[model samples]
Target: MSVKLLVTTVLLLLPYVHTFSVEKRVSKLLSWSKSENEAPTILGWCEERRLQDATELQVTVSCGDSEPLEVSIPIPTDENTLARTLWPSSLAAAILLRLPASEQLVKDRHILELGCGLGLAGIVTSSSAKSCCLTDHDEEIIQLLKNQNIPNIDVSYLEWRDEDRPNDIPPSDLVIGADIAYYFYLLRPLIDTTKAMLRPDNSAFMVVGQANRESQWDLYHNVRDGCYNQLTDEREAPWNGETRMLLYQLQMFKWQVDDDIALENQELDGTIPIAVMIHTSPGLENFAFTTFDHIATKNDKEGIMMSF
Candidate 1:
């Protein structure tokens, strides 16, 4: 009775013992997996806190007559570069908007701001513009702009190298950029993008930059070589008692020649004719003349008017 009863009891209890051992191992495995998953969650929370700390800086910008604008800007670091901080040129651009002349250029107009890092200039301009589009290539910067929820403005992703502009960006009456031309390679693309974004008639491009930078000189030469004509002289805005900011107002050169004039010149000379037009706009007094080969003289002009 003892051996047979002991063997039966051990076999019956063996199955329950194995089941309990298996459950204990499963519980341990589940706990390990939970901890592994939570490690990343904890790390993510720490990264988020770090980001919040990096972006806690806020800037207040005051333009003429308008109320001051408060913007939350990220602290600039080596990693973030120009896309995080509100530069001094952006402040100058905001102040430029206060001028009556600059006001006329933006009032009731569709405006576009390129490379809008902290969106300071765009935010200031939005107060007067009919509508504004703030654009940058960085997704994080775009998210920053969206977080601002500024009125009368839309935020979009715009890369300088993108062949096609975003559909949401309308033909802007005034295109603005602040401290965007820091790189030599990006200058031509910036000019081309500005030209493409601006209206063919009655539109202007306003760019503000630190005047001392070599990139600014590159931008000036590029703009001069391009199809644009400078409308306003180089306006200086002093900053930090050391840096000088320059604001340039540029308009695309538009040529309108009468068919009669061309025909008469061809009939009389039997050769390709040269057209000379005179422009009489404020701050601009130069002649834009095109030879037979469509070569325009370098004489700076505002709006060209020509007749036989």
Candidate 2:
């Protein structure tokens, strides 16, 4: 078969092969949404020379009543190792889809996704967030991100291990990652990076996921000991039928809390009910839900923030 025909065939068959993988569907949804826009975005090595199985990916994100945003990303045709591939692991897909699916959590928020392998999470959230940045330590990954013509997102290189942080990257309201806690040594750098990029105010939240590995559990303790407060913890089965994956929503804070505000405000009378929070935005008069609950008490100028 001709190289063009072979590459086309592989692209077509890829959906069927990875149908159960949510990331594949997210990519397809991105591609489809892009095609629906003013112009269809191009991806992959479109040079005269085509590599076999050099695939392109798409990611789609939607907010309430808004047109879904789509991004077309190219996958490197050279790398064949397990470490480098465009395919999204189960944890990655979960983290990408976790917040974007909720209009209240993502809409109008400035988002950043670190160690974005294929940038699936950032791309998926770009449509909903006011702004988004997708970054990775790998030079090749940054090149791949540059190739994707995603609207309303800044694609850049951000190394977590760098002692001097890059000045170009802006602070974000939310930070996200997937399967980032692969090794024990990466724990500190990832935590530091998360802290550096966040807004430092109580409003910012970080959502990350990891495969159910015993070693990765150390990350939980490290985060708690650090400046973050753990919010929601949930588990799900992977697409490939592997062990359950853990998803965590952690709240970032600049100031240390002397007391457990969440524990104390659990039953405050003046607090608004949960029904109001699902529709309200933070920093507004209406109640908004964070990793914790908020309660207004007498003589308190600001409502107390509580973590779930």
Candidate 3:
């Protein structure tokens, strides 16, 4: 088979294959439960233990010659409480503090933090921001943040897959996240949630993490292909021996086109011009070309001009 034909066939079959795989997994779980004659139970339920033994640790953060601010964070002792860790949160906080003061990226802006496990970064930034919202999907984490009673900061539950959560969140001037893109399946929902929570223009999202997984690279490409434009050059810092930390600043893509030219072209050809911009790296030109060609082919009959 030709390469194009094979690619098209796979694309068409992907949805059905994904659905079948999900159904098969569910069936296996049901069969196992029936064989055992009881409901399946997850091991290491640590909610009670975490609440009982959680300790508070003070983290001091300083920005641009400002007096250091100390934040007390609850340390979850349970092995399953990965969300409550402080490594990437510290890294993300450092990056946010390192942002140039001339840009005023966080100062006086409405900042929102996604997956704000221990609320480290948000709490640190709340001092400069007009208001800050710290969000996490875990109920226990939300409760912990609320207990802190930090002024000018709000704590809320936010799961990216939950569409209603975005409606409750106000449009933010800036969105920040740390170590949220560790899983491949989370990229789309996280990006969608960030876009929903941000203003249509002049808003930015900043995310930081250790570049130890492929998902982080996928996140970069996903943002590039989506409605966001990179605001600053990619920033990296040395973390441990071999692992490097990376930060990305992305703003919503805004069109800067001449209305008169667009109108003239539309009047001349009786077709609207649709601009498709692709931001790509050295090795991704073929992917961009394939995307442009697909859109052009799909809209061939429509009264639209596809400009890449």
Candidate 4:
């Protein structure tokens, strides 16, 4: 064959070779796990997605239930763009589904998923949580999430860029996100939003793939500094091939709920009764009475009640 012919042929076959290599890697990585009868299982299937060099992976993820949840996830063609849904979300979904039966945190607890692209993880979480909300900053994504008929899951807009707590959505017992820490600018906003959305005493858990990326590390340090306690796990993933990821579980040191309650108290008028109750030792009764009198006098309140 002519050198020109050989070069052209090789060039033309490049895409095919790349595709085959990716497919082989994916197949190896996605090999079936032990059945749920014995342990947690994340059973999955894949199909080529139209108009993109990507695949749609569907998984029957089990969480100690007789029937596993069927979740559809679209892998991104380009990892650089935030417009495409990424694989970390799918991994996070699987992790949420595979929570052990002993850990009943999801049952009867309100959950929130932040940066919930396509609502994959959030939707899966809805099965276990009392109520699950799928939230993102983009309107188009929110609209796409709303089109799906997921039971016990609601779609809402939550802009991390906004410094204040988003209105209307109730506080959640657990907050979650997947592949959300890809940019430097979003670091603080993401943490702040998590703080606002969670109920008192609970922390947020976030899963991020492509752990080697510099951007992800920057976000991790920021989170470590900002959060009271942060824990991380690393594992292999099969989305784009055998990729490693870091799962971060962050706990806020102090509940913002206390601050909210203080604000609410400040807003309240003194029309309601203000009570001072103290069970004192017999010898300290006079001192307790004096303290109550001082408090009542300072407040100038008529409805102050004292209990022994």
RMSD of 4: 22.9
Candidate 1 lDDT, tens digit per residue, 153-256?
89999997888888878998778887787666776678668767877556656666644455665565545433332333443221111111222221111121
The digit string of per-residue lDDT tens for model 4 on 188-271 reads 577567656665443234433333344554444444333332223333121111111222211112112222343223332111
Q: For candidate 4, what is the lDDT? A: 0.46
Q: How much does candidate 2 score in TM-score?
A: 0.52
Candidate 3, residue 230: Cα displacement in angstroms equals: 23
How many residue pairs clash per model?
0, 4, 0, 0
For each candidate in turn, the TM-score is: 0.54, 0.52, 0.54, 0.51
Question: What ranges in model 2 sit over 4 Å off?
Answer: 1-52, 59-71, 80-83, 86-101, 226-308
Per-residue alpha-carbon lDDT of model 2 for 206-250, expressed as tens digits? 334322333344455454333232332433221111111122222
TM-score of 3: 0.54
Residue 270 lDDT in model 1? 15
TM-score of 1: 0.54
Q: How high is the lDDT of residue 168 in model 4?
A: 71
Local distance difference test scores for all models? 0.52, 0.47, 0.51, 0.46
Worst 10 residues of 4 by lDDT: 24-33
RMSD of each: 27.0, 18.2, 25.4, 22.9
Q: Where does candidate 3 stray beyond 4 Å?
A: 1-54, 98-103, 227-308
RMSD of 1: 27.0
